[model samples]
Target: MAFIQIIEGRTSRFDEMQALTEEFRERSEGASTVRRGIETRDRDDPNRFMVLVFFDSYESAMENSNRPETDEFSQKMMELVDGPPTFHNLDVLKDETS
Candidate 1:
């Protein structure tokens, strides 16, 4: 099944968080497990941010989560937020084309 991870974080450190996310994007370019990701900011609350990450499968996501690079990325993410980020794992049910 296709998996989606919805991550939410505080917006106080948007710039720093964006930089960290960009770094991860650059490092994960050639990674086969990570399919794609999008970063979004809350329209009402500027201090709120969310990241939608898609992986080929749950197993692939787990594998990518365990990589050393991911650990480093996690560390960087922690530094830019007030509290721990939230992650919601979901199984995609439908697509617009379908």
Candidate 2:
């Protein structure tokens, strides 16, 4: 089943955060299990943001999580955030597109 991980946090350093994300993408190219990633900032509160990462399966997500690059990115990302981020691990039960 498809899996999605939701990461929410508040960061005043979005530009740097984005750069790190791009860098990670480059470094993990071809080896990453990430199917897609969507980054969003809250409309009412610009500092609040959420990242939705999609993967083919829960195991794939875990594999990606265990990578050294992922660990490095996460540590650096934490430094840019206001506080520890919240995470939501979801198992996709339905998906459709028009």
RMSD of every prediction? 1.4, 0.6
Clashing pairs in 2: none
Enumerate clash totals for all models, in the order shown: 1, 0
Model 2 lowest lDDT segment of ten: 12-21
Model 1, span 1-98: residue lDDT tens: 88888898885879888888888878878874878888899899999989998987889889999988898999888988989988899988875673
Instruction: List runs of model 1 lying over 4 Å from the truth.
Output: none
lDDT of 2 at 90: 100
lDDT of 2 at 5: 100
Model 2: how far residue 5 lies from native, Å: 0.2
| Cα lDDT listed for each candidate | 0.85, 0.97
Give lDDT tens digits, candidate 2, residues 1-98: 99999999999998999999999999999999999999999999989999999999999999999999999999999999999999999999999999
